[model samples]
Target: MPRRTRVLLVLFSIVTVLCAWAGLMGLGRLTNSGFLPDDAPVRDDNRRLSAHYRAGGADLVLLVRADTDVDSAAVAAQGRAVGERVARSPGVVTAVSYWSAHDPALRSRDHRAALITVDLVENEGRATRAAQDLVPGLTGRQGPVTVSATGPAWASVEGMQQSRRDLLAGELIAVPLSTLVLLFVFRSLLAALIPLLTALVSVTGTLACLYALTFVMEVSVYAANVACALGFGLAVDYGLFVVTRFREERAAGAGPDEAVTRSTRTAGRTVAVSAGIVALSLCCLFTVPLGFIRSVAVAGVLVALLSAAATVCLVPALLSAAGALLDRWDVFARLRRARATGSAGAEEGAGWRRIGRAVCRRPVLWALAATAVLLAMLLPFGHAAFAPSDARVLPAAGEAHRTQEQLRRDFAIVPDRTVTIGLPRGTDRAALDTYARAVAALPGAAEVRTADGVYRGSTHHPAPAGTAPVAAAAPAGPVLTATAASGRESAEARRFVREIRGLPAPGGSALVSGEPVRVVDTTAVLSRALPPACLLAAAVTMLVLGSFTRSVLIPLKAVAMAVLSLGACVGGMVLIFQDGHLRGLLGGFTVTGTLDGAVALFVLVVAYALSVDYELFLLSRIREEYLTTGDNTAAVIKGVQRTGRLVTAAALLVVSAMVALAASGVTLLKVIGVGLAIGVVVDATLVRGILVPALMAWAGRWNWWLPGRLRRRAATGDRHALSTDEGAEHAH
Candidate 1:
């Protein structure tokens, strides 16, 4: 065997063993965690209590309305029959109907409407079956009842089920399409298979890790879906980088082993640097407050890291082991070899001489134009507001949303804020009376009913402190209850929270516990975390590129391009989503002014890494030309021309995948997909093709200039610039 082949095979075997062991270990850890499907609503305390009160109460909610009246003999009988059937469900905990409560209004004022609450089995798979059973049975034209399923149970069971299907649809579409693109790009099944295998193994391993994460942290149901998308997408992208370079080297008359070595050393470095940047960017999510957002960042980082490692380590080994058999399935081998038979281009210095001559001709004009354009694209983002979505997070077409809309329209309620202020189960009557007045008098106070030892308002419903619904009789003293509005001033809600925090303990017993408060707390945490994460990612990118190019200016250029790419992507998404251009196509979801907290962070990270891919591609070629010719101009032109086609192809494939995601009914998915896709296009064509080259052409030798200290350090050990006469000729 050739020495290079021997080296690659040995390295490949070692990494293969390591990856297998790691995958097995990760799986072992995953197996220990409980299997709660992604959409399970076991997190809410009320839902948990409801579940305990009636098993599966958190998974199945039935809303039955009568247009005429719920109390009529016909309506009552219908309600009873429905309740009885629901009660007999295999996993039902309890059934509640208007007749069951004897509340006239609960039956609806016109006597036409009533609600049926059916709690199902707690297990997610069982809950799903029972919930689905309730929906079809309750719908009918003749019956007075118009039944709709709503609440955490329905979301957890039904919404989750649909989400899984949508995700599967995205994956099924992405995998095959990506494979075709890979086959075209590599011209061989063997080369394509290496990356595909790496993607599959990495994805499976990431999922197993995600399953294991449930033990150390809370993982969102959506996190798994995102992992598959990001992990596989990144895998394909990284695989493309490595595989393309390996083939390029081989076609240049390098042996299989030599090609693997060259590909690993050159393209592998770029993949590593880019992956690190991507992971670091994703880790920025740790600064956000929501567990869902944090989980996405964590999962994405894990997957990106693994994908990068696989591309650099696993792929090389596979290439080494397969040798020429790797290209055996390539239909274009003869054509490709024939193309390579042509004479090489000008030497390094000669090409650079021509490029430098052209650039020095009009440096000022080129620099001014590039800066002005990028600044204009970045301007729109200043108007961008980070708005959290409420409705779109749930399934687009669902009962919860319909019910929520109805509730909002009829009652003037905002479903965004659901909170409860907790008081001890038993408290002093005097303190309760005082607190009730204080809550009722608040500026945003809507209607506060102080019956049943609880204050109930239209706004604050969680653990309501007012009467037990208007139907239930009032409770005696030592009971806690209340509800209030979101507050008139908008800031009033936040101000009220502050007031509540400052209020005298009222016998040292009152505490506030609710989702809103949790959100506020989480936001604080996120605000502190985001900046550091961004800086860290930027630092890493700068360091890696600086090391690779041994050029201070090029690293700075890469960072600038990355930032511009992010701004362009986010700005375009804001236009598409916040502007509501595709609302109808995306299941009629209203684009909130801003993206979800988690989605924005993730899209930003992904965009940054994508920009880095182009940066590295261009820089690798440019630096190679520079070292050989000692002329920056020639390097810029030759480098752009050489990598331009590959970059364009990669961008197309990536953007296509992103556009596919944008077609999803899920609003967040659509926004993220469109944003990322648009960003890749902008980076690949506009920034990489035009802006980067123009800037380099203007900078001349300064493009490769490093400070004295850094230059000496790079000279000692980290020399990435390889400028040989043959290499220059081939590049040209």
Candidate 2:
């Protein structure tokens, strides 16, 4: 058996290394595009138009600033040279500039800076790579002008780089801190290492699995941050539960082998069931048609499965092999020796039982107070604004973000965000001309440049001397270069897109595509998906809990409590991240006044699963006590006493693993981390500690009521080990 275990360990090591290799390769393949569904009008139209026109809405933008007039002979010649250089670069589809086009609209309001826009290849990943390669060369001082870049491709590159840095920094802080906490909680140095090792295995495996998933479907880089963190946290959490329960069995006088068996039967089952519910919750994210949401969903499911596998298969064997040595390197020697001698058992749960009694004494008041506090946290969510991520989500001073800030402050027209009204090719010039003229008349419309000419409202102006055709249709169909317009998040840009879409085409026409339009479509799809995704997750979670407990009412109560807990967390996120409160304390991230819709959805899924995980932990102990004592109130008190510390310890481990995300430079990851940390605290204290026992006490025997068949099976010790026979199984 020892030889077999050795061989198995060797095999696991090989697989883990291979998974790491795959994950590395997968990271190279990660792309920031494909977020919008293929069928989304904006996505489809963007692709279709890119094929027809010299446009993909400018993947890279260069702001060429001259010491004086940008159009001066020297600056114009230098700027045009820069544009030509960009145009000749590999992977560049088209490049246009104020110097080359001599178009008035391309000039900044101050006339000291001019815009140089490059349209890269239609493939989003390649486009971003090309921009990344080009930005270093084009930015900084060149001949007669200083240049800086900001656009979609640059934003993508910046996001990937910052995310990598944040992930590393976060882990550095999270791992060591978590190790110390686990050392104390587990009562031994060697024992504490189990969860960390298991978490490493699960995280690497999940990353590798996610990379493989990339081949079959679109996976977002955004997904990796939350997925790996969640995988690590889950593995660590499971480790704490399984090992703690093993110690309990030993304290109860069971032999090491028997203790492993009993703990696995109890804690192992709970972890497995917890994993199933979490996986199922993540799977529900597929109902959202957006690519990012689906990517997170798939990655989360993979993490849950991998984390559960690592904890279950590896933890038990280590415990068995160590036997008497499991507590050898006791970090807390007195506590370890006391637990081993069963002396700690006397005082282990007295405090938690007292807490349970206090909460039960005023069940209604406690429940009401907890609910009200949760509701207060959720208050900020009432004003929650959802937006698509942009350079704003990056660090405040990143080149791409800084350049974007400059553009926002100085440029009258953000050409990269131009609303392109796709007019079918081969339309008559007269109809197209009319359409262009009408579009040029819209608010913030400075000039509608076309193959034929430029239009400012009803007036027609001849095309600039050297400017190539500016129409989204080479024929120029009302390409609203939103001038003096606010940012894409602003009412002006949204109104412009909305009004443009509302306009009738004079010729053959199809779609209105731009950043604002994409944001509108994304938020719309997410809004529609949120209700169904949450409902599906809730319904399925209840079913799983129902099966685990054999009590319908228990599952219902669990669902209510979990949602209430999560709602409060979401509110906290809105208050801090969106409302921009506590910015300095949270890594000094810039508040964008709105949460990324995709990130919010991901957070919701993660926090809910965690809430339910603790729910299952507490319920298992409560149900176990009730079955043994046959007194609901006593069971509630004892259950909280026995499991409260375990639940709290598990919550701490999960939080430690997640709080590393707060170390990330990226606000999105910080939001996920801090939100989850807050979530676990709420679940551990308010929901599980107070509301749970209080509600159970108020429900009395109804908490154990399981209708007809389930009650009988539960009595007979069928599946979950709730009867005396099942209890005897623990001592075997």
Candidate 3:
């Protein structure tokens, strides 16, 4: 390319990136829907039922804490005033207070703090905006009552906001750490920084892609976090591979153009295959219905492919343009020149070669040891608990988190756990009474509220004097809320949900909605979807890798390694976060005793992708060396020796991002960070460094085995590959 054209291309690229950055900034409007699918029955029912009742619990709640008993006349009067003020707010459709309704469920067990449940207008977008505008004012002093506001809308909005803040904080740390590692590995300031150029483009480009996607689909806020973090990490990865290869080729006496050509031919193929496999793995997430999971999948696949393209297209351009000036700083040369002078026999890759030989010497023993270790890591997963995230995952200072904490500590029946059952249309008075009584009679029911009244055990209390009814003309029919205090994700609460779901509908049908019901339904959805997603991910990964490497066994082995890596990582998470291990080391967050299934699946795809990423780095060299020499053991050793440092540099960059996540206050983010970092480190060091080389050595030529018919086709198809590789030696 001419100098003027190169300069023009660079300027155009910079302009494009700046626009993407601005587009990403405008994504401040991004929001995450409460961890429910768009098509969940609860959404439709709640929209209709919200018109008449605080259906599926309050969209907003004002907690009134007074100096004296909440039932005292003075406090009761103030609480009623607070409720009326909230009710008079423009968007509030209804506001029911403990004082107004005299409902036991609305009052705290200690009678110090009581709730005023507020339902907003039905349109979600307008309701959310209304809650955001109204909630801040409703909090703070209200005469004698000190009010704090929270509810489903408040928590969702707060969590989304906090997550974006943390994502910024996380990248602030991750980028520097990754750069430091790259600096050390490359040993030149420009060399270290050049790879990050690809990262800049990859991240901005992905956000631009997502911004466009938001026009057609509701993208989760978490998707941008995934795209930016993982994009930078993977972009650096491809850059490291290609830049290192170019340097090696140049060092071995190739001209600049010749070196770029060979490096792109060899290392570029690995980057393309790596991206394809990772993209294929992410594609499996479409099996899940949740927008949260599928959103991450879309962002992940986009970043992976874009990262690969950015690195391949730009790194070589920069390297060739810089020419001999690329190594000007030459920190490694300055430091090691004396050693090279003292010992002429010293050479690159000696350490990695020695390690490979050691592992290959006892292949079965090493493989078994690694297997046993990974299995031991997985033991805790058998007893692992799963749940959707609640307000507790937000920062401690957040109003929703504080409100939830107070509810858990002071209330006997958390209104948040109240499951609303939407009764079928045309329910007569008799059936409504019968269904309410039956639900109230269930073993774990805390209290049941029908349109007519409240029921506790065998007792019934008529509705407060002026409360609106579920109109007979309403298409949603009737709505009832059953408060259960067994804990939203607890076995007991879920059991209550299941039992009520099994109950015969009073008129004909019912739809359950609330915290516990959401937990149950989400868990069930993931349980059904995850297995198929994993199967598809693994099967498709094998097909992609197999076609890329022309090796049946290597792809299968790659899948096994990735699965093992993911299992061990999640098992480690179950042990630490779920089982409450090392509280001090993790910055003293609460152990929620369960993993977020959605976050787990997100981490699963990421860890699996990284595992295969390292595997491809290793396999590419081995495949190249093996074809050149037709000697399996030699190829295994040489491949490990050649690409070992490149893999380590890439692995450390990815791990740094995860480590930043581990430091977050959000327990689920911490789980992802610690778990994925540990998993990637183990895979890069132990699995890639040991088991892969050992197994390949033991398998010999079978490591590259393909059916005879396919082998012939691959040979015929790879003529250009052979021509490019004609003069390649086993080692630089």
To one decimal, what is the Cα RMSD in angstroms of model 2 from the true structure? 3.1
Residue-by-residue lDDT tens digits, candidate 2, 1-732: 376667767777898899988987787666666556545678777766666655657778888998989878999889989999999999887788887666766788989998888878876677878987888888899988999988888988888887766666777877887788898787788788888878888888988988888788767786777766787788888888899999998998888888887888889989999999999998898888777677777878988888888888888877877788888787688766677697644687788989999988889999999889888888888988887878877888888888888887887566545676667655667887777777778885666666667677789977656665545345333343433245566556667777777788755455566687777778777888899999999999989998888787888998899889889988999989888898988778877778888788888888898899898988888888877778888888988998898888888877887877877877778888988998999999999999988999999988878878778877776444445446676546
- For model 3, how does the per-residue alpha-carbon lDDT over 1-732 read when each residue is reduced to its tens digit? 668549855774886668587656746766666367556666676665666444535778778998889989889888888888888988887777887767666778878899888888765555666788888877888777888877777777786677788777888988899888887888776877777888888888888888878778777777777776787778888888888998998888888888887888789888988998889889998888888788888988999998888777777787777777877786677667787888789768888989888888888898888888888888999998899887777777878888878877887667668887777667888888898899999998988877677788999988767654321123557777788857887888889988998889876678677778778888888888889999998898888888888889998899888888888998988888788898789777766778899888878887898898899889888878877788888888899899887788788988876767777766767877787787888898878998888888888888877788998988776665765566454332
TM-scores for candidates 1 onward, in order: 0.75, 0.93, 0.93
User: At residue 569, what lDDT does model 3 achieve?
Assistant: 90
lDDT of 1 by residue, 1-732 (tens): 457657865765565566556544543222111122122222243244333322222234455776665667887788888878877877677675656755332343344455565556544345655666566666554376667766444554444555456666887777787778777777888877887777776676677677677677655555656676677677877887788888788878887777887888888888887777778767665655455666667778888888887788678878877887877788777887675666355342343344434544565665566566766766767766443444344555666666545534433323233333444444565665677667655665553333333344423332234213321211212322223366211355555545655666455644442333433443345456568767877887887787777888887878887887788777777666766766665555655555554467668877887788678877887787777677877777778766766777678667656655765656667777777887888888678767788788878778766788877876654343443435634654
CA lDDT of every candidate: 0.62, 0.80, 0.80
